[model samples]
Target: MTSTDAFNTQGNATAVTDPHTGETRYNRVPQVTWDFWLVKLLAVTVGETAADLINTSLGLGLTNTSLLMSVFLIVALVFQFAQKRYVPVYYWTTVVLVSVVGTLITDNFIDNLGWSFTPVTLSFTAALAATFAVWYMVEKTLSIHSIYTFRREAFYWLAILFTFALGTSAGDQLAEGLGVGFLMSGLMYAAVIAVIAGLFYGGLMNGILAFWLAYIITRPMGASFGDYLSQPVANGGLGLGTIVTSLIFFAAIGATVWYMTRSKDGLEVAQD
Candidate 1:
């Protein structure tokens, strides 16, 4: 049977037929919009600051913090998958946890294993590319609009994790390892993302390509901004401290999620 036939047979909660591909999908992820990008950026920023807070300020150490956060991430993913539908709270919660865990994973390689930044970034990039290759080969599409099946969702989260790790490593390499400073690095990423957006709006790029490009760039951009706000003045930051930065972004994310939960405008709808 066809994809549409399979979706119809499954009787999903919100199946709709894709006009372009003639495929039916359940719309298990949120629609890509301004709000979606805003919350995502906040979540990554919190991820960087919060990881530093727990590992350094709280004195948990990198190993201990990674262990603790990894456990929580697993638990969050369990609840997320259990929902079998896009729940704003659970979905964003998972994203936040994954972001933190991804940062910690990269940190472990550098601090514990003594791996350098370039190798870590390259490794994660390769991993993410492989994931996309396999996902496309298996599911025939990498568009977020088709994230209706459990397998697709699994691939989606895995790719997200790699993006976070890759972003962390690349951002740190440029900002700290290369001495570009956090603010400058953030500006660089922002410019690149802006160019990508311009291309999309000008009808020179595909929507899926634009979406993934922005998605990957946002990770480092958020991390750079987070470090700039939270690090000490000696370290080129604003000296706001991790506690304040994390709390501010947490509130922002919470407010956005609350609005998304109440508004159909933020919810995912299958393409007609």
Candidate 2:
């Protein structure tokens, strides 16, 4: 079932509730919606372009950039976890930082260690599967709607990190390793997401399954889209350069988060 379905099934009287105690709880994450997904795509795209800008254009190198972004991610997470409930600005900022860190982690594995994309992709896939397995074993549910506890939030973030890493490796594998160009790769991933959405809306697929599937695909889609915008024309892109690409996506993400903050449109909260 989808998270909304699960929530309704448990109790339709509230925005959130403890299944065991029937006490109201608040989610620390935003509700999944069109806007949420849009911002997420922007965040991942910025992750790709911003990482390239910092590592190459700014001459920080992959290792240095990774180190710096890692520190930033830790600080972002500190503020994110400190909040008792969802705050759009804090939540999206943490997501953006996580996206950058995830890209750097994958880049380091490939460029610095000379690891093949196949192994890197496989390893991250295994890690994500393991995380889900453990999370389900402990929580008995993987519904995003149930992410009202610290432990669940931790598992949620870990899954997100792995998804970003896996997406980076898989995107690179398809575009660079397998010789597909960025635009084509982006189109391919977008097509897959469309199919998944069709299945979900058609009632042929489980909601949680569809949500996670679309989530995973968006990473590669965003990566390919970013590369297409930022790379040179000879490389089958728009030749926008990393700076321009990053700035565009960063502005998009910031605007979306600001809207969410002002409207509280996607904020997760309990209903009375």
Number of the top-ranking candidate, with lDDT as the measure: 2
In angstroms, give how far residue 72 of model 1 lies from its true place: 0.6
RMSD of 1: 6.4
For model 1, residues 1-272, the per-residue Cα lDDT tens digits are: 22221112112334466568976545667777677888989999999999999999999999999999999999999998876457899999999999999999999999999999989999999999999999999987777766766898899999999989988898788777667888988899999988987886676877667777778888889998999999999999999999999999999999999998887544555532
Off by over 4 Å in 2: 1-23, 270-272
Predictions: Cα RMSD each:
6.4, 3.4
lDDT of 2 by residue, 54-100 (tens): 99999999999999999999999889888767889889999999999
Model 1 poorest 10 in a row by lDDT: 1-10
TM-score of 2: 0.91
lDDT agreement of model 1 with the native: 0.84
